[model samples]
Target: MLSKRVVSCFDVRDGKLVKSVKFVNTKEIGEVVGRARQYYEDGLDELVMYDITASSDHRDIMLETVEAVASEIFIPFSVGGGIRSVEDATDLRWAGAEKINVNTAAVDRPELISEISHAVGAQSTILSIDVLRVPGGPLPSGFEIVTHGGRTHTGIDAIEWAREGERRGAGEIVVNSIDADGTCDGYDVELTRTVVDAVGIPVIASGGAGKPEHLYDVLTEGGADAALVASMVHYGEYTVSELKQYLHERGVKVRMHY
Candidate 1:
C-alpha cells in the first residue's frame, strides 16, 4: 500500500508566514525560513511553500526565500505562486524546489501546464486548485475553482477541472477548500473526493485539517494521497510526528521516522 504523507504548508505574504480564515484577515506567524526549518526538524514528511500574493501582484516567486527555505530542509519541497512560464518554473527548480505549483498562470493559459510539464517532467508540476463552494451553476457539484490567492472566482467545475488538469499534465493536485479554510472544522471530504475520483494523479487535500481524524478521513474516505496541514500544526497544537503516530495507531500507513 502507498504510505500516506503529512505535508506542512506555509502561506507567505511579504516573506512572512501568515494565517487567514476564509482567505482574509491575515496575520504573520513568523519568519518563513525559520518556521520551515523547525518543521523539518520536527519530522514533517514534506513541505509546501507558497508566495500567496505573487499572482495578485503580478510578480515572480521569491527565489531568495525559496533558496533560504530549501537550504534548511532535507525532504521534498515544492514552491508555487507567480510561476507564469517555463522559465519561471526552471528558476524555482534551480532554486531547490523539487516540484512547481501553478495556479493562476495555468488557469489563464492551460497550455502552460503542458509546457512546464514537458520541460520539467510531469512529476515536477503540481496544480494548486484553491476552490470555494457556490450554488449550482455550470458545475453539477456546485464547487467553482478560485485563483489569484482565492480572490478570483473562475466558473470552472472542480471535478471537470481536475480531469482536465490531469490530461494537461499536472502530476498532482492539491485541492484546497476555501469554505473550510482556517476554520479547523475538518477537511471538505466531498470536495476532495470529487477531485480524487475525477483525476488519476495524486490528490493532496488542503484547507481545514483540525485533527488527526480529519487527515485520516481525507486520506481514506476522501481517497486522497496526502493531506496538507496548516493552522493545526502552525499554532503548535500538534506535531507532525504525533499526528502521524495517531494515524498509524488507527491503521493508516505513514512514514514513522527519518
Candidate 2:
C-alpha cells in the first residue's frame, strides 16, 4: 500500500478560508493563501481548496483567491465548487490548480466527468461525492448522493455513481460524508469502505476527522488512501505535522517533514 498522505483542506467562501459543521453556520478562519502556504511548508502531501458556498450561492469560484493560493503552494492542489463544465475545469487548471474537483456538476451530468478527463487527462479530474445515510430503517436500494453544497439530494446511488465515474475516467474520488463532516466523530468507516470497494481508483475520505488517531483509523481500519481534514486544522486544534507524527507512531506510514 502507498504511504498514507496528510491532505489539508481549506473551505473558502467569498475568498476567505472558512469552517463549519455539516456545511452550515460557517465561520471565517484565515486567509486562503496564508493557510495554503503554511500547510505546504509544514509538508502536507496535497492541498484542497473548496468554495463551499459557490454552488449554493450560484457564483463561480473566486479566481483571484485561486491564483493567490496557487502561487504560494508547490504541492498538488485541487479547487472545487461551482465547476460545471470543461471550460470551468480548464480555467482552474490555467489558474494553477493541479486538479479540479466536481461535485454538483458531475452529479448533474456524469458525461462531463469523461469529457473533462479526456480534455485535461484523468489525473486532473476529481469527483467529490457527498453522501449521507438514509434516515431511519435500512438503507434504500441505492446510496444517497447529495448535491448543491448538501442542500439538495440527487436520489442517486453513490456507489453506482462512483463506479460510473471510474468507467468514465475520473482519476480520483473524494468521499465526503455530510453527516460526519465537521462532527469529527471519526469518519463513517462503513460509508468509505463501501465506496472504496466499489471503485478502482484512489479514494480520499473526507469529513469526521477530529484527531490524529482518527486519521490512523481511517487509513488502516477504513481503507482510505488519504484523508481530508478541515475543522481541526482550521480551528488550530492540531497541525498537519503533528498529525503525521501521531500517525507514524501508530504504525501508519505517513509522510513527515520533521
- Could you tell me every candidate's TM-score relative to the true structure? 0.93, 0.92
Count: clashes, candidate 1 = 0
True-structure lDDT of candidate 1: 0.87
Q: Against the true structure, whose lDDT is highest?
A: 1
- Give the Å error, residue 24, model 1: 2.1
Model 2: number of clashes? Answer: 0
lDDT of each: 0.87, 0.83
lDDT of 1 by residue, 117-184 (tens): 99999999999888889975777889998975567888888778888889999999999998888879
The reply for model 2, stretches above 4 Å from the true place, is: 53-61, 135-142
